[model samples]
Structures are given as C-alpha cells and as structure tokens.
Target: MTNAIEFIHVKKEYQEQDVIEDLNLSIRKGELFVLVGESGSGKTTTLKMINRLEKLTDGEIFVNGKDSQAVSDRKLRKDIGYVLQQIALFPTMTVAQNISVIPEMKKMPKSEIKKLTYELLSKVGLKPEDYWKRMPNELSGGEQQRIGILRAVIAQPSIILMDEPFSALDPLSRKQLQDLVLNIHEKFDTTIVFVTHDMNEALKLGDRIAIMSKGKVLQVATPEQIAQNPANDFVRDFFKASLVKNIYDVYIGRVGMVQGYITEKPNQKSMLVDSQETMRAVFKILSKYEYVAVQEGKEILGYLSRQQVISYLSEHEKD
Candidate 1:
C-alpha cells in the first residue's frame, strides 16, 4: 500500500530542547497509526506538523506524495480533519449548523450542505430530527464529541488527526466514542493518526504504533510486535510498567471464550492482555466461564480462572 503520510528525518526544536528528532515514519493508506508516549514526548507535535498546524524546524513531511512544506497551508488543512481533546462546539449554533460550517465556508449549495450534514450526523450515530436543531449545551459530552467528529467527516477529508479526542469523557463515554471511531474507520477507510498517553487505547486502536520519547520515535510496529520485541531497554521498561509478561505469547495468541465452545462458533471475544491490562479484563472473561483457550498461530492452550492466573503470576514473581 502507498504511504498516505511520511516523515523523513523529521526534526522539531523549541528554544533549548528538541521536541522531535530524526523521526522517520510512514502511515500506510487507510491504516490507523497511533502515536503513544509520556507527556512531552512530541507525539501531538508530530501530528500537528502533518497539517502545517506546526511548522517543521527541520526535515521533510509528505502527505499523499506531496511535500507538506510546498502545499498551501489552507489547502492542506482543508484536506485533513482535526479533532482535539476539548470538543469546541459553537454554543449558539445548532448541530446541523455546526456540521455545515466547513462546507458553507467552501460555498457549497445550502441544500447540498444540509444533506451532507444530516448524513454525517447519522453516520456518527445521532438522529437528525432529535439533534439537528439542538444547541451544543443540550447534548452530553459524548454527543457533542460525535458532532465534532461529524463536522470533521462531513468535509470528506482523506486523513484525520485525533489528539486525545476521548480523554475528557467518562469511562463509558470514552469506550463508546472509541468504538464509534473504529466503526467509522471500517466504513470510510480514512487514514487516521491518533495520539494518546493510554497504552490500552493505543493497543486497541492502532494498526501500527509509534513509541516516542524526548521528541524522537523509538520504534514503530504492530501492537503485537511492540509487546513481544521492544527495541531497547526504554521500550522494555515501558511495557514492563504495563505488567506485560511474555508480550509475544499474549498478543500473538488467540484465547477461545467458553461461550464459543458452547455455541459451536469461533471465539472472537478473546483479547491479548499485557501485564498492565487491568484485572478487570481478566475478571470479565472469568465471570462467564472457568477456562479460556489460548492460542499462538495454530498452537492452542487453556488457562484457568483467577486462582490459576494468580498462582501463575506468583510462581513467575519469584523469577
């Protein structure tokens, strides 16, 4: 697949410190690429540079095969949709009006823009009659966020940039929005660059993840690869903090859900958990059955309940 975005020897500096240095990365067309790291790691900064929101201090960035530096900033931004942590919706405008803002600016026909706005709202899981005339304050955080995304997608941008778009929501709300984003990706196949500090979010959403520190990309790989083989001690220690043991064993393997066996259907609910995944994930699975099947490639094994998992942890704890 052709690269939708590429950073070649990209460098960014601020005053006395470098925010990103010699970063080389490529996001394939229609893939969700996540950038993850501790605060101040330059992940967000790197994202902004793609749309010319942040000027590069050094190096080259190409979007759809054209150098970002050479493209008109306004045109480049128009072709990319951006959503941030705080959803800044217009208080006075109705949902339809808000979503139609960009298209209106481009002088699209009012009737066509309204049609597009309604379509986008529906795509984002909102009913047109209920939400069209409602003010931003009338909606919940999640609803407002969906509107923000609807606004972005209505522009029909080929790529989208999201910087912690769900970070401000409650847990349930965040999960709903995350699932919504994934569903949208499946349908639209737009290239997405998602930035977050949450490792679980990165693992769940990224087709490929870029780990950054001190303004540099340390490694870029699939979630499974990063867990199994970290590039260096920093990467290893980072995964360790997440409580991942045998990263390769966990991510690359499939665990059959007990329900699957009973239903005579393939298990799709199983997930790979790093040592860092909350006890909640394991507990959730255990609540339904006593045994879960684990697999790597064609090799399959079974794991027991909390007691068994804990006992396994304890035995390995001594090591």
Candidate 2:
C-alpha cells in the first residue's frame, strides 16, 4: 500500500535540546496506525510534525508523497483533521455548529452541512434533535469528545491526527469512543494516526503500532507480532507491564481478547476448553490434541493449537 505519511531522517529540537532524533516512519493509506509510548517519548512531537503543529529542525517530512514543508500551513492543516485530549471545541458554539465548522469554512452549502452534521451525530448515537443545539459545556466529557471527533472528520479529510483524544474520559466512555473511532474508520476509509500511551488501546485499534522511546522508534509491527516477538528489552518490558496477573491472563490477552480473532467450528474429535480453565487443564487437553476449541459459555470462540500455546507461554514465562 502507498504511504499516507513518511518521515525521512526527521529530527526536532526544542530550545537546543533534541526532542526527536533521526526518526523515520511510514503510515500506510487507509490504515489505522498508532504511535504509543510513555510520556516524553516523542510520540506526540512526531505526530505534531506531520501537521506542522511542531516544525522539523532537520530532515524531510512528507504527506501523501510530497514534502510537507512545500505546502502552505493553511492548506496543509485544512486538509488534515486533528483531535486533542482537551476536547478543543468552540465552547461558544452549539454541537451542530462545532461539527459543521470545517464544512462551513470550505464554503459548503449551509443545507448540505446541516444534513451531514445531523447524519453523523446519529451515526455516533447522539440524537440530532437532542444534541444539535446543546452547548459544549452542557455535555459530559465523553459527549464532548464525540463532538470533537465529529468536528475533525466533518470535512472528510483523508488523514486525521488524534493526540490522546480519549485519554481524559472514564473507562466506559473511552471504550464507547474507541468503538466509534473503529466504525468511523471503516465507514470513511480514512487514514488515522492515533497517539496514545495506553497499550491496550493500541493493540485493540491499530493495524500496526510503532513503539517509541527517548526520541526514537524502537519497533513497529502488528499487535500480535509485537506480543509474540518483542524487538528488545524495552519493547518486551513495556508490553509486559500491560499483561494480566498470571499465565492464564497472559494467554487470554494473546488469544481471546486483545486483537479480534475469528471463530471456526471444531471437528468431531476436537476437545473443548473454557477460556478460564487453568493452564494445567489446558496443557492436558493440548497434549492429546493438535488443537483445541476455546469457548466462553456456549460460544466457541476459536481454535488454539498446542504449538501456539507453548510458544505464547515460553515468551512470557519470565513474567
């Protein structure tokens, strides 16, 4: 796939101190890409460079294959959508007004913009009649974020930059918005560069994730790839912090719940096991069969091979 964004030996400095060093990365078009790391890891700085929220001290930055510096700031930012942790809505404007900001700025017909705004509001489960004229201050944190997200994509920009957008919300709201983001990505087929310090969010949302640290990117891979094969000590330990209490938790994190897994029916001879079964019980079943069907209650989620279980265990045995 072609790149939506590319960084060529990029570097950034703040007050004579290097904030990002020799950073090189590519985000593919139409993919939900994640940049994740602890604070001060340069993930946010790297994201800002893409939209010129932060300028590059050295090296080339390209958006859609053209040098970003060549594009005028107004044109560049207008084409790229941005969402922030602070939920930066026009506090003075109503929900409909906020969502229609970009469309209006582009001189779209007032009627069309209103229609699109209401449609999007309903798509996210926000009833138009109920929320259309409500001020930002009247909404809850999650509700405000829903509007912030809607505003970002109002212009149908091909690329959206989300910097810790959902970090400030409660767990339930965070989850709801995460689903909303996934749905929006699927519906719009837009490229998203989401920044987060949360590993679980990264694993759950990204097609591929880049792990950054100390102004450098340490590894970039699919969630499953990173789980099974961490690039180095930093990568391994960083992910390790997010793993559950024991081997069972670790196994579930890998197979059942972290990334989406498809379900397939088992054969007549296949043994069945509960996801909550102890590792010893699973080991016994695995020893006799090449693979076993894993289930939760009556639902058969998917199959896990003996080798797959062993491989996952060996990798996390140290934890």
Candidate 3:
C-alpha cells in the first residue's frame, strides 16, 4: 500500500543551522506513526512541515502520493486535521460552535454542521447534551482537550497530526484521552502522525516509531524491535532507563510473555488490563489468580502466573 504521508530527503535550516536534516519517512495509511526525541530534536518542526505550517527548506513531502507543494495551501490544510499541545479553543464560542468552526469555514450547511458537531463530540467521549453549550472555561482541561480533538476530526480529514496533544493533562486524564484517540483511530481508519517526548506514550500509541535526535532520525522500527534490538548506543540507553524504572512500556502488554498459556474459551477466568498499564498492575492481578489474562484493549493474549510475573520483574531488575 502506498504511504499516506511521505518525506524524501527533507531538510529544514534556519540561519545556517539545520533543524531537520535529510529526513526520509513514510507513514502507511491508517497507521499511527509516532516521533519521539529530546528537546530541540525538531520533531515538532517536522510535523509542521507535513501540514505546511512550516515551510520545508529543501526536498519534498507528499500526502497520499500528491506533492504537497503542488496543492493549494488552504485546500491542503483543510484535508489534514491538526491537534496541538495547546488546546486552542475559542473562549467566546460554545463547544458546539468551536467544533463547527472548520465545517462552517468550509461553507457546510448549517444543519449538516450542527449534526456533525454533535457526532464529533460523541466520538471524543463527550455527550452532546452536556457539553454542547459549555464554554472553554466551563470545561476541565481534559474536556477542552477532547474538544480540540473533536474540532480537528469534524472535517473527516484523511490524516491527523497531533503534537503532544495529551502532554498538558493529568496522568489519569491523559490515559483516558490516549485510549479515546486509539479507539477513534480504529473506527475512522485515519492515518495519524503523533509527536511526543514521552517514550512510554510513543510506544503505547505508535504502530511504528521514529526516534530523532539533533535533527536526524536515529531509528525507525516497531516498538518490540526497538526494545529488543536498539540501533545504537543512544537507543540502547533509552531503553535502559525505561527498564530501570520498571516501565517496560514497549513490551508491557504484548503477547508471548508466558508461552503456551493462551486459551480460547469464552468466559474464561481472566484479568482485563490496558496495554499501557504498568507491570506493577500485572503483578497485582497475579497476586489473586494463578493465571491472569493479559490484554490489549478488549483482545485477550493468554495468561501469566504470579511466579512468572515475579521472575520477570526480578530478571529485569538485574539488567
């Protein structure tokens, strides 16, 4: 399948310093591609380039096989949705009005826009009746964040760009929004390019990750591949820190932790857990059951015992 977004030898320089250098990437249709890096790594700049919010200094970017530069800026932007770190809601506008901004700008029918606004609110886990008339100040930080997402998705854009959209929320709210985004992605099948400095968040949400540093992509691979086989010393140290913290984010809820234990019986005694849940949560579950089920969303991926959980934790501690 052709990529929904592609960057070829893309470079961005300002005053003789390259913010992004000779970058190449391809994000497949309907896949979540995450970019992770330290501060000043240019992840945000690269994302801006995709939506033409930032002009590329050199090379090319393509969206759905069409040259991005060839498209009219307004039309191109209208085809891509963007959610930024700041929840840029219009304070004077109600939730429904804020969400309808894009569609209204597109000259959509009033009735159609109203219907779509309600649908988008529901999609972002908000009830229309409760949230529609509320202003930004009346909503919680998390609720505002959801409104930001709803505004972006209201247009049914083919691709979405998220720049640390959950970074400003509390941990509990962040987790809720993360799961909400994943659920929406699955239902809508929209290609997403998400940017974060949080390694755990990147691993949990990304289908593939691109690790960047000093304006260059250091590694691009599945979370498992990056964890098990780091491409370089920096990558190795990255996982090392995660391991020391007992946050094996990449492999937290993946299959094959306990071999030959997955069963197919419906209503089987099992524990339900989020893929992004901590290993400590797994241990707590194991404390109660001989074999506790592991899960990624609603799908079961076999079971592990108390002994296995303890043993795995011990071994990782040694590392």
Candidate 4:
C-alpha cells in the first residue's frame, strides 16, 4: 500500500508559462499506473519529473518515499529503469551488450551479467544464439523495442518509467508489446508508470488511469469508473472518443443514463460485455441474462438490464 512515487504541489515552468501547476498525485508500489492525455497535456512532463528528466521548478517529488531532490541523478536513474518510444538503443552495441549495460556498470561479474542477459532475452522470446550479437539496425522495429524493454528491465529495477514506449510500433506489434508489459508486471510485481495518449491502450493496461489536460489532472480512477462515470464533460468526451461509432448514433455509455439501467456494484457472477461493444453484442448477452455487466477491459463499469435495452430499441424504432 506504500507509494512508489508522490508529487506534492509540483510546478514546472517553461518560458515563464506554467507547464505543470499545483500537481499532486501518488502511484502505489507494484501497481501498473498510467498517465493519459493528448499533446502538451503535461503527462509526459509529469513522468519525466519522477526520474528528474525534467526538473520541477517548485515543490517536491518523492521516489520510493524519499525526496527525489536528495538523490544524485546518476544514482537515482541507476535504480529506475526507463523505456522510450524511440527505442534509443546504442546503435554501436550488440543486443546482449545493450541488455547487460546496467549489470556491467554495477560491476557485476561478467559471467553473471551474461547469464542474466541471455535469460532475459529468452524470457522475451528472443533466441540468445541469434540475437546476442545483432546490432540495433539488424532488428526490426518490434524486435528493437523488445531489446529496449530488455535493457530497461535487465537490472530488475523496482520502478520503471515508460514514455509512450509502444506508440511508434504497428498495431500488431503494439498489442504484442502491451501483453509483454502486462506479463512482465505480473512476473516481477514492479511498479510501472506508463504514459500514453491512446485511451484504448490505457484501458487495456492501466490498473488506474489519470487523465490530464493543459498541465492539470482532470480525473484519476479505474478504467471502468472513468468509462461509466466520467468526472466532467471533458472526461466524458475523452472516453467517448475511444468508443465504436454506433450505428444508432447513441453512445453505449450514454444509454444507461438516457434510459434506465440500475447501476450496481460489480457482481462476480454477472454476464459481462465491454462498454465499447456494439448494441447487437449487448442484446445477445441480454437475451440469455436478465442483466449484463458493462465493463472496459477487466474493470466493471455498471449493469444494463434487458428491459433497459429493449426500451431504448423500441424508442429508436419508433423514430
């Protein structure tokens, strides 16, 4: 239950303009927390402050319960792993060399470093024999990213900072890397702070997501809560932008409010449908169940009774 990172009254100014103002947030240890927003929203800036990539003009940031300012950047970064969208591997280094950078820097025994490097490469589905000596350009985009992630995690840092790490890859590669990240978190129980502009990506990967705009956080909640009960108009529209454009032009999330569906605490036995599912899909589940739970990813948003769906359909049919 301890916080891995905390921002207190944080502020960052650039050219006399407030890039981040009065920010306060905390990320729990071993949790996969996400920061989501569009460009210039300060989500990226907020992430950088944790590792001191962007220095805060005012206030404090605590990493692992200690004042971040108290630690030298070199030492702090050594304990924290970082992954980036650009996959900034050393073009001159081999894959094994890149993955073993941290351990080597720490003066770990050469044999130990090689053992760990090969073990991690295999963990990510790369063959040690084939990839050990490959240069950055020898790998494909996705392969390069896999190596980038390996480099970050090779040292087994408890906290990892990911800045749009998968954003530059193709859709298939992105999904694969996302799954890899989820698997890594489960396997290591590491505290991860992931930043991305894609809402769908956030919902799929975040245990809790914080939405930001104009250097301010708009809402912070589970993906399900944000989907069903957005904190404001901006939040609502942000969630909406990720939904499928329904043929009826009625947003599924809006149907519960416009019609009548009992919002209840998530029940373990309820039939489930994603909030992004089409109306036809909801009807199929409703045909067999009295009520179906609406969810986004693994989080339950609310419930929609069969009656609620029928009533809305009949009303639309009449029109």
Candidate 5:
C-alpha cells in the first residue's frame, strides 16, 4: 500500500547541531504510527515538520505521497488535525464555537458546522446542547481534552498528529482517552502520528512504534515484537523502567494485546472479549473460568487467562 506519510533521510539541526539525524520512516495509510523516546529525541520535531509548524532543516517529507513542502502551509495544515499536551481550547469560546474554529475558517455553512459540532461532541461522549454553551473552564480537564480532540477532527482530516495528548490527565482519564483515540481511528480510518514518552501508551495505541535516541531511529516494530525483542540495551531498559506499567496497560482487559502468551487457540466455544477491553474489566471471568478469547472486530486472536498473565509478569521482571 502507498504510505500515507514518508520521511526520507530527514534531518534537523540548530546552529549546526543535529537534532534529528538522517531519520527515515514510512506510515501506512490509515495506520496509527507512534514515535517514542526521551525528551529531545526529535519525535515532536518530526511531527512539526509534517505540518510545516517547523521548517525542515534537511531532507523531504511526503504526505499522502506528495512532497509535504509542495503544499502551502495553510492548505496542508487544514487537512491535518493536531492535539497538543496542553490541549489549547480557546478559554473564552463556547464548546461549539471552539470546535467550529477551523470549519468557520474554511467558510463552512453555519447549518453544516452546527451539525458537525453536535456529531463530534456526541462521538466523544458529550451532548451538543449541554456542552454547546459551556466554556472550557466549566468542564473537567478530561472533558476539555475530549473537546480538544473533537475540535482537531471536526473537519475529518485524513491525518492527525498528537503530541503527548494524554500526558496531562490522570491515569483513568488518560486510559479513557486512549480508548477514545482507538475508537476515532476505527471510525475515521485516519492515519495517525502520535508522539509520546510513555511506553504503555505507545504499546496500547500504536500499530507500530518507532523508538528513538539522540536523534537516531533505534528501532521500529509492533508492541509484542519490541517486548519480546528489544533493539538494544537502551530499548531493553527503556521498556524495563515501565515494565510493571506496561503489564498493567497490556493486561487490563486486553488479553489479545499480549496474545503471545496463549497456548490454546480460540474457537467458537471460546469466551469472547473485545480487543479494546482491559484485563481489569474481565478479571472475574478470567479467574472463574480458565480462559476467555480476546478479539478485535470479528477476529479472535487467542484466549487469555489470569494465570498466564501472572506468569508473564513474573518472567519479564528481569530478576
């Protein structure tokens, strides 16, 4: 499949100091690609280059196969959604108006914008009428973040870039939003480029994750692949610091996520759990019964068990 985005020998430097060193990557159409690294790893810098928020210091970026530089900044950005850590929803504006900012800029009809505002708010678990007149201050941080996400995708952009969008929220709220992003991705079939310092977030959300260090691409692989086999010592310890966190994120209602542990294959008789659900949600079922099948959409990846989960956690402890 033609990639939705491609980075070719990309580099960025300040005062002749390289921040992104010869980076190259490809993001497939409709797939969520995550960039994970410590601060100054250039993940955010890479995302900025896509929208021309930061001018590329070197190399080329192709969005939807066309050179990103070929498109003018204003027009290109109009087709791409962005959510920041702070989630800058205009404090003064009502929720509807906040969401309608870009659509209004695009000269969308008032009726259409109104329709879109309601649809988007509802999709993110808010009602239009209730929230239409509410200002940012009236909502909780989680609600505001949800609204910010709705605003980003109000235009239904083909690509969305998120920079640690949930890092500011409490763990429960963050998990909810992660589920929201997964839902949005399914609904829109969008190609997402998410940057995060959280390994658990990357594993939970990314179809593939690119791990970086000091401006270099250290490794790029699926969560299971990286967990089972890290690129090097840095990648190994990178996952280690958060090993318990990773297991929590991986196991919570999501046996399908860590499917490599399943010894028995799933079948029609197998108990079913949504791939998006977490281990915590289904612990009773797992403890009472021996296993439950983990599924995404219609496909069953495998069966999950509490024992296997406990065992996996023990093995990965690096004792």
Candidate 6:
C-alpha cells in the first residue's frame, strides 16, 4: 500500500544553505508519526513542506499518492489540518465560530457546521451549550488549544500536522490533551504527524518516532524498540528521560499488574524473580547478581538491576 505521505530525496535550502538535505521518509496511513529533535533540526521545515507551506528546494513530496506541489495550494491545505503550540484562536470569534472555521471555509452549510461544532466540542469534553458562544478570551489556555484542534479537523482533513500543540500548557492540561488526541486519532484514523522535542511526549503519543538532528534522521522506531535498542548515543540520550519515567512506573505500579503471570523452568544456576515479586524484592535479589531475570514460566518479561533502580530514584528524588 502507498504511504499516506512520502518524501523522496526531499531537500530544503535557505540563503544558499541547506536546512534539510536528502531527506526521505514515509508515514503510514492512519497512524500517528512523531518527529522529535532540537531546535534548528528541520522537523518543522519537513512538516511545512508536506503541505507546501514551504516549497521544497529539491525533490518530491506526495500526499495520498499525489505529488503535493501538483495540487492547488488552497485545496491541498484544506485537506491537511494544522495545530500549533501557540494555538491561534481568533480572539474576536466565539468558540463555535473558531471550530466552525474550517468547515465554513469548505463551504459547508451553516446547519451542518453547527451540528459538527457541538459534536466535536462535546468529544473534547466541552459542553457546546456552555462554550458555543464564548469568545477565545473566555476559554482557558487548554480549552483554546482543544478548540484549535477541533477547528483543524472539523473539515475532516486526511492528515493533521500537530506542531507541539500541548507544549505551552501546564503538565496536567498537557497530559489531558495528549489523551484526547490519542482518542481522537483512534476514532478518526487520520494520519497524524506530530512534532515535538519532548521525548516523553514523543514516546507516549507516537505510533513510531523519528529522531532528527542537523537535517538528518537518526532513527525511526517504536517506543519499546527504541528504548530496548537505540540506534546510537544521541538517540539514547534523547530518550533517557522517558526511560527513567518508565522505571518509576515500575516502582509505583509493579505489584498489582503481575497477577496471572507465572514463572516456570527456572534455570537452577540463574538468578531469577517471579513476575509476582515486587520491584523492592527484585532490588534485594539484584544485590547478589548484576541483574535478576523477570520471568513468567518460559517467557522472559525482562530483567531488573540495582543500578537501574538507583538511576531511576536519583532523578526522581527531590534535591
């Protein structure tokens, strides 16, 4: 099957200098793809090139199997939704007006747009009746961001480009919005290309993550795959925070979820811990061995090490 979006030898240059060089990637249909990198790394440039917001200096970009540049700008943009970190909700417009912008631009009927406004607002947990007539100033930062995303997708675009949409919000609000996006993606099955420098966010939200640096892609991998096998030191350092956070999850959530997991075929010479054992118990076992294998019967779930536990706590403990 053809990819939802493809970049073939894509390159972007500014002031006779290349910002993106010989980049090639394919994002799967109906999956959330995340781009993670530091500033000046061309993640945003790559995104903008997809919808022709920025013309490619060289090479080709295909959206839904059609050359992106071959399509009319206005028409192509209408088929690609955009959400940003600083969500630009028109302060003069009411919530309904904001969400209805895309649909209205598509020349949807007023009646249909009205129905969709309510339906989508409700999906994001905002009651339409309470928020329908409220201006952007009246909504909280998080609420405004939600409305921005709602506006982007109300036209039912085939793809949504989210550029650090939740980066500006507080942690709690950011987390809420992340869950909402995940739900929205699952329900709509739209191809989403999310851009962020936050590794934690990338791991949590992406179906697969692409790490970029200096206009080149370092690795493209799933969360677990990347965690277990980083392509290089750069990729490993980028994901270190998320890896530590997962260790904390084990510390806090290790007990209850182990039910029904069984350990068998215990190699008499090997150090092992049953799945039912707590991380604290694993810590004690690790004192005698470099690491203790976590097994459920013949299946090896993973292993635990005292060094990993210490490393996890070192970051989490308040100074």
User: Which lDDT values do the candidates have, in the order given?
Assistant: 0.77, 0.86, 0.83, 0.86, 0.84, 0.81
For 228-277, candidate 5 gives per-residue lDDT tens digits of 99999999888887655555445444444444647567443446777656
TM-score of 2: 0.78
Better of 3 and 5 by lDDT: 5
TM-score of each: 0.77, 0.78, 0.79, 0.77, 0.79, 0.78
Candidate 1 per-residue C-alpha lDDT over 1-319 given as tens digits, one digit per residue, 9 for 90 to 100: 9999999999888895788888889999999999998899999999999998898898999999999999798888887989999899999999898999887887889989988887777776788988889999999989999999888877678999999999787655776688888987888899999999877778889999999888888989999999899999988777665444432123211222321222222344444333223343555665665544444445444443445554544543443
* Residue-level lDDT for 21 in candidate 4: 89
lDDT of 4 by residue, 1-319 (tens): 9999999999999999999989999999999999998899999999999999999999999999899999999988888999999988999999998888887898889998899888888888899999999999999999999998988887789999999998877665776799899999999999999999888789889999999999999999999999889999988887766443222434355576677557675443568766655577677777778887777668777888878888887765643
Please report how far candidate 4 places residue 18 from its true position, in Å: 0.9
> Model 5 compared with the native: what TM-score?
0.79
Report the C-alpha lDDT of model 3 over 1-319, residue by residue, as the tens digit. Answer: 7799999999999998999999999999999999998889999999999988899999999998899999989878988999998989999999898989988888889999988887777777789999889999999999989898988887788999999999877665888899988987998899999999888788889999999999999999999999889999998887666556634432445324533444654353656666556666666676676667666667766665556666666766776
Of 4 and 5, the candidate ahead on TM-score is 5
> Candidate 6: where is the Cα deviation over 4 Å?
241-312, 315-319
Least well predicted 10-residue stretch by lDDT in candidate 1: 251-260
Q: After superposition, how far is residue 88 of candidate 5 from its true place, in Å?
A: 1.1
lDDT, candidate 5, at 78: 81
Model 5: lowest-lDDT 10 consecutive positions: 250-259
Ranking of all candidate structures by their TM-score, best first: 5, 3, 2, 6, 1, 4
Backbone clashes counted, model 3: 0
- Give the Cα-based TM-score of candidate 3 against the true structure: 0.79
- Writing each residue's lDDT as its tens digit, candidate 6 over 199-317 gives 87888899999999999999999988988899999888767754454343343124323332223433433476665454555666666776556667676776555565565456444
